[model samples]
Target: MSDVSARDAARDKARDRDGAMSMAGMSSERIESDENVWTRRLVTFLRVMAVISIMKGLYHWAQVTGFIGSEEEAFENQSMAWQTATVYFAVIELVAAVGLWLATPWGAVVWLTTVVSMAVIELMFPGIYGGSLTVVALEAVMLGAYLALAWMAARERPP
Candidate 1:
């Protein structure tokens, strides 16, 4: 072959070899790490919490719209405190749910705030939600789980 053709063939072979090496490097880099596993678990937990938040928000909205109560217990007929709480929760819970679903930092903050607020209300102002200890306990457990998962995921990250 001519010198020019020989040079071109050598360059093509080099490029092919480099391409194969890069592909192999990419596959090796894809090996699952502890951080990746923990992050995925955290994401899944957040998604589940988001669904629960959505349901809670919808429930509050139903209450406010008189869709889940008797005529006498309608939103207009409820005490001012109940009306205010229902509306506040109806809006905030849904917002928090969206944030959580997105798996963003702000979403976790918002969700935590919502959980703590509900727990406090249930404990300190029993009249609002009729003081369900069960609800408070559940919220505490969920909060603990979230914190644990977040801690694990963060710890697994490379410094």
Candidate 2:
């Protein structure tokens, strides 16, 4: 090659390397920002869910402890199925709430299980929780939101 052509080629290669390096750095910073954004969203979502779970759990406990109904309609006077359902929810909801508040993987799993279980009971049995369609729909929406946020956060992670 001519001297000028050789020099031009060398310059082009150096420019390409510098451009690649800068692009790499910019992309990494962007990825980190995106990751932080998604992670914060996910954590906030989980904490909100935890609060809801806590409320639900407390409601169930109130029923079991006779704090909600009249003395004549207390937990001891409830049907076997109602008592069983209330007890189950009282325990599981609190457990899941704790997990979600911590934002741990197990918390997500537990919350998912809790949501699915409530949906199932509302759909299949229809008598456990009064079969509230609104409750079921809300649960479905929350579940979808949680899954979407988790997916987005996971995608932002570097390989």
lDDT of 1 by residue, 76-116 (tens): 98888778888988998999999999999999999999999
C-alpha TM-score for every candidate: 0.81, 0.77
Off by over 4 Å in 1: 1-33
Instruction: Write down the worst ten-residue block by lDDT for model 1.
Output: 28-37
Clashing pairs in 1: none
Runs of candidate 2 with Cα error greater than 4 angstroms are: 1-32
lDDT of 1 at 102: 98
For model 2, the local distance difference test gives 0.91
The lDDT for every candidate, in the order shown, is 0.91, 0.91
Judged by TM-score, which candidate is best?
Answer: 1
Cα error, residue 60 of model 1, in Å, equals 0.5
